[model samples]
Target: MKTLLHAAGLAAWLAMSQASAGISLNGTRVIFDGAHPEASVTVRNHGADILVQSWLEALDSDKAELPFAITPPLTRLPAGQEQLLRILYAGAGASDQQETAFWLNVQEIPQAAGKGNVLQLAVRQRVKVFYRPPGLDGDALQAPERLRWRLRRERGNSWLQADNPSRYHVTVTGLTLLSGGKSKEISRAQMLAPGAGGQWPLPADTANDARLRYQIINDFGASQAFEARLQGVAPAQPQRLEP
Candidate 1:
């Protein structure tokens, strides 16, 4: 029989929450201003002594790269103490046209093993990091309200395409698609940046009379709901069989 610390068991434990939580990040999101080449994030250990590992991942990449560097990538943070991790961008993948985003993951691992039948799990926390380029256009706070939405059909599937024309990122949550007296909601949160767009799969019939309602995550991480109907979008027509 495999113990709870086995590979599979550990994987399951990683997915669950531990009672003795210790690590916390300063901000829900990190912004890397273009004018500066470095940014810092503060990590606080509120419970027991633990080792925290930090890394950065591109939005669509599976692995973390070195365009950015974290000071003391792995460090032991004592209880009630805090560590400031500096992030340096070498301009490796920087784009002058629009803003780019990445994910910052901080994992906390306990340092001591208690003598008992106690289960301890490592806690991993992830946050978004936005790299803003100079002279992109518009204010970050107004970006969400400037977003444009459309309902489209491709390859027999219906989708909602959200376009962000500003230089700032607009995080959307609680999105719902309403049509034909029926309503469906998005399962996860989405974020769109300047000149960037994302497609959310929707019901085929919903394309005909689709209206989208969602909340935008502001610079402070607060959600504000808004509703709008897709504009300049044509509904998909069902194929007809020839007799």
Candidate 2:
């Protein structure tokens, strides 16, 4: 009954192997914009039990471990079902060109099992950052004057006037809107001489709740910019003048 015992032992080993199962991760990739980056992975479970826990890993070209590894939230996958997991890389700084090599490590904890299994998946992606440079005009170039905007009259269309003195060949560059808790680029122009500094006609439906920033650029790549608040004020009603 030595033969019978040996056969029984082999059957038990096969049964144990079949019982311990895991999920497979496929089609892993990292996506990066100039400002933000994200990772996506596809998980497929082929075992008879559910998978409850999972993790990921990222590596460089030399197989060195990355300082930042994303662990997706714990989830359960029914047997033979698949799901997609996503992770975001929230880093700072603006580098135009940086190569980020990465990969995925998917771990699955099977239900009613004491130990979990891990699967290794691979991925690679590059990062790109972008920015704009300030522009300049001819010799009459000087640092752009700081703009202090004031409201003259409130009417149908809002009007804004800057207390700036016009200088020849000195144009404004890098005029931007840093309002609504966000930054946005604006157009540039050369101010004509002999008049009130510069006037920006506020558009109808314009919310006077943003800070304006502007810069003066010279021919030599030199620039200066400043910020000013666009304080909210009550609109004035049109007054009828006696003839």
Residue 181 shift from truth in candidate 2, angstroms: 70
Candidate 2 lDDT, 65-163, residue by residue in tens: 444445455678788888777655545332223233344555666456456763322222222111111121221332233234654446677655555
How do all models score by TM-score? Answer: 0.78, 0.33
Best by TM-score: 1
Off by over 4 Å in 2: 1-20, 28-37, 58-71, 93-96, 113-243
User: What TM-score does model 2 achieve against the real structure?
Assistant: 0.33
User: What lDDT tens digits, residue by residue, belong to model 1 across residues 76-152?
Assistant: 99899999998888877677777778889999988768687766777899998888886776778677777777787
Residue-pair clashes per prediction, in order, are 0, 0
The candidate that wins on lDDT is 1
